[model samples]
Every structure is written in structure tokens, then in C-alpha cells.
Target: MESIAIFVDVQNVYYTTRQAFGRRFDYNALWAKLSQSYRIDIARAYAISSTDPKQRQFHHILRGIGFNVQLKPFIQRLDGSAKGDWDVGLALDVYETANSVDRIVLISGDGDFQVLVERIQQRFNTKVTVAGVRSLTANNLIQAADDYIEIDSDLLIGQ
Candidate 1:
């Protein structure tokens, strides 16, 4: 059987939910739903590590939750700018895994992923879906996705 790959941008989901819906993310619940939909042979969460100890612990939590965690250290530019880019990592992983997977599930709300989604579908013929909360997502992103799941309800209760 062909496998599925799940790529999550954790910070993006958290900030979008906090800013738009005010609901705390239930990652376990979300993961359950995604697994139910796809074979999910590879699961990854890309995160940035700051000086804070909590960030390190969060990375562990992700590993404990059965995801391959990729950590990028937070870099501060001399021009008084902070930089952390998970998009590049996410896209590269998706591309690398696309040939092996039947489907690619991206757990993020960033509209910027539209291009990557398009490329994945056109090149690999992989079914691409953007699983995100309703009303908190970009229209263009949804349009670009081959399929979409708007997690607007209590999908956490094994529903």
C-alpha cells in the first residue's frame, strides 16, 4: 500500500487558532483524524527552538507523540531582524517524500503553501490536502489544495 506523509507547522496552527478562533489546539485529536484519513507512514512537525527551555520540552513532546521532529534554532540578524523559516524545510521534505506517498497532508493555514501544493499535485499526482480550521484559512490555499478538511467541529472525540 502506498503511504501518506503528514507535515505540520505547529506554530502556524497555534497562532491562527489563538488569533481567530480562540480555541486551544488539541494536537492529539488532530493527529488522530489525519491518521484516520491516510496511511501516514511518515509524520513530521517542523519547529524552531528559542532560548526558552519550554521550546526544548515541546520538541520532546512532539517526539513522544510519534512524529519525527526537525528543530531549527532561532537566528537573529544583525539588522535587528529575527529569522526562522520552516516553509523551506516543509517543502523540501514534501518533495522528497512525494514519490513514495499516495497522499500528502499539510496541517497548516498559511496561504503561502499554495504554490507547494500545486507543485506536489502536478508533479507527483499526489493527492494534496490542507487540513485547517474553517474561517481561519485563506481562500487561495483551499483552492489550490486537491482536497480540504475544515476542522471546525469536535473531531477530537473519535468522530
Candidate 2:
């Protein structure tokens, strides 16, 4: 079995799912399917800390389902624009753990990771899989991946 590490972008998934389907991603179902195919070495979910009780509860649930929830403080600028992203963090973690794993599964629609994906594939000879909402996923990112898993109804809650 391939040893796989999962990297999840919580903010991206939350907003994209709410925008695309008005429902949450079914993480439990995702875990079941992914764990079936690969030996999961580490599953990390990056999230911005919020005061919402429901969001906090959701994070707890993610932990129960075997994710290591990494939280960042929500930042609001003077111009009212908010800033909270985990691209660099995710990249660093993946790079640090690359040699130990055979596969890397990244869950995000952001295209900024295309280069990182390419590097991982080329340098480590690891299979890279991108999982994202189809409509929101970046074309370059998908093209760069060794495999792509669309976050369709089967991966969403309440299909």
C-alpha cells in the first residue's frame, strides 16, 4: 500500500463548497475512501480560527475523523480585507515529509500549488493527487497532478 499524506485547505473548501453546492464536504466519507486505497501517514487540515461555535465543532469533528487540525488566527486588515492562507505552511510540511511518503493528496482549488506539485512529483518521484471542487479547481493544478479526484456529489454531504 502506498503511504499517503493528506493536506486540506479548510477555508478554501468551506467557501467553495458553500458557493458551489450550499453544503459541506463530507470529510468522513472522504477519509473512508482515501484510507481504503492508501496507508494514510498524516492528514492535516489548515483552518482559520473563528468564533463561530459551529465551525469550532466542525473542526473537532475533523479531529475525531483522524485529521490534525492546524489553526491560524483570522486576520482583518484596516482596509477590511481579510488575510489567512496556508499555502506556504502546507508546502513546507509536504516538503518536510516528502521523502517518507509515496503519495501526496492535496485538497484545494487554489492554483498557487501547481509549482509545488510539480516539484514533489519530479524530485521525490511521488504520485501527487489533487482533490477539489471541479468548477473551482485550477486547470493548471489539475494538469500538474499525476491524478485528479473531483470533489463531486459523492464527496459532499447530503448527496
Candidate 3:
């Protein structure tokens, strides 16, 4: 079987799942399922570092779960804008590794990834899958993906 690489937009999935389903995510279970389905060369989860101790612990848990935890400091702009630094990093990682990996699994509800998915598919013919809570998912993102996994109670809770 070909190897699969999972690229996760941490806060994107975290916030959306909370808003749409009102349930907590089971990261370990979800990762386990993905690993079982594929050789799983890469599992990168992107998150911004926060002063919050709990957030730090969450990051630790992700690392313990076999994911490459990419931590970028959360930059709060003077103009009251909060910057998300991972999108570009994720894109770069995807561009660099898409050809080497057989499948790319994206975890985000953000619609901006439609272009990324299209480009990867057009250029590399890599199977791209998106995992997000169904309610908040953008139609374009969903359509661009080869498969969609709605991480809900059944998925998170391992039901």
C-alpha cells in the first residue's frame, strides 16, 4: 500500500468542530484510523503557540500521537490582527512532498485550500482528502478533495 501524509490545520479543525458539532475531538483515534488505512509517512499538525498552558499540553499530546507538530508562534499584530503562519508553511510542505507521497490528507474547514488541492492534483496526481466537520465545510474545498472525512462523534470518539 502507498503511504499517506496527513496535513492538519489545527485551530481550523478545532474551532469548526466545536462550533458545528459541540463535541470534543479525539485526535489519537482519528490519527490511528488514518495510520491503519495507509503506510502514513507524514502526519503534520500545525498550530500556533499560545501562553495558555493547556494549549501547550495539547501540542505535546499531538507530538506523542506520532504527528510532526509544527509550532509557529502566534503573532498578534499591533493593528489588532492575529496572523496564522501555518498556511504558507503547509503549502510549502505540500509542494515539496506531494510528489514523494502517494496520498495527502488535509484537515481543515478553510475554503482557501481549494486552489492548493487543485494544483496538487493537476501537477502530481496525488490523491487528496479533506477531513473536517461537515457543517462548516466549504463546498469548493469539499469538491476539490478526492475524499472527505467528517470528523464527528463517531470518528472522534471511535464509535
Candidate 4:
């Protein structure tokens, strides 16, 4: 079986799915679907740390699904904006893991990751599969990826 590394941008996915489909992404379904075809070497879900009971419970659920839930403290700025980005960290990890894995699966619609996807594929000769909401995902990102998985009802909760 081919080795694969998975990275989930939890915040991006949550917001995009809710915005586009009014539903949550089904991680379990994604796991089951991918596992059949690939040897999952590493799975990481990046999220913002929260004290909310629901958030904690969600994190626990992700852990139960075999993901390493990485959290960064949520920052509330005085300007009324908040910050909890994992782009840099995620990019670094993916770059490092690229050589070891045959493919990298990134779950996010953020256009910022386009460069990272392109670079890793070119430098490491690794296949990059991007899974995101088609309506919300950037065109450049979709073009950069080796394969694109549209996040539809099949990948959403209660579908």
C-alpha cells in the first residue's frame, strides 16, 4: 500500500462547510474512505485551543478517530479580530513529511496553501490531493493539487 500523510485545517474546513453546505465535515467517513486505499502514516488535525466543553469534546472525538489534534491558543485582538492560524506550522510539517510519504492529503479551501502544494510536488515528487468545498476553494489551489476531492454531502455530517 502507498503511504500517505493527512493534514486537516479544522477551522477552515468547519467554516467553509458550514458556509457552503450548512453541515459539518465527516472525518470518520474521510478516514474510512482513505484508509482503504492508503497506508495512513500520519494524520494531524490543526485547531484552535478552546475551553468550551463542546470544543473539548470535539477534540476528544478527533483523537478517537486516530488523529493527532494539534492546538494553538485562540487570540482575541483588541481590534475585534481574532487570530489562530496554522499555515506556517502546517506547511513546515507537510514539507518535512513529503519525502517519506507517497501522497499528502490536505483538507482546506484556503488559497494560501497553493504555493506549498506546488512546491512539495515539484521538490519531493509527492502527490498532493486537496479536499475542499468546490464553491469556496480557490481556483489556483485546485489547479496546483495532483487531485482534488470535492467536499459534498458524502463527506458531510448527517448526510
The TM-score values for the models, in the order shown, are 0.88, 0.96, 0.93, 0.98
Deviation (Å) of 68 in candidate 4 = 0.4
**In candidate 1, what are the lDDT values of residues 14-112, reduced to their tens digit?**
777666666656667767776676676999998887678887887787788788998898888999999887998898999989888899889888898
By lDDT, the candidates rank as 4, 2, 3, 1
In what order do the candidates fall by TM-score, top score first? Answer: 4, 2, 3, 1
Worst 10 residues of 2 by lDDT: 150-159
Better of 3 and 4 by TM-score: 4
Clashes of each: 0, 0, 0, 0
Which scores greater on lDDT, model 3 or model 4?
4
Q: Give the TM-score comparing model 3 with the true structure, all chains together.
A: 0.93
Candidates in order have lDDT scores of 0.81, 0.92, 0.86, 0.96
Cα-based lDDT at residue 121, candidate 3: 96
Give the residue spans of candidate 4 off by over 4 A.
none
| Best prediction by TM-score | 4
- List the pairs of residues colliding in candidate 4: none
Error of 1 at 13 (Å): 1.0
Off by over 4 Å in 2: none
Answer with 2 or 4, whichever has the higher lDDT: 4
Stronger candidate by TM-score (2 vs 3): 2
Query: Which 10-residue window in model 4 sums to the lowest lDDT?
Result: 150-159
Structural RMSD, model 2? 1.0
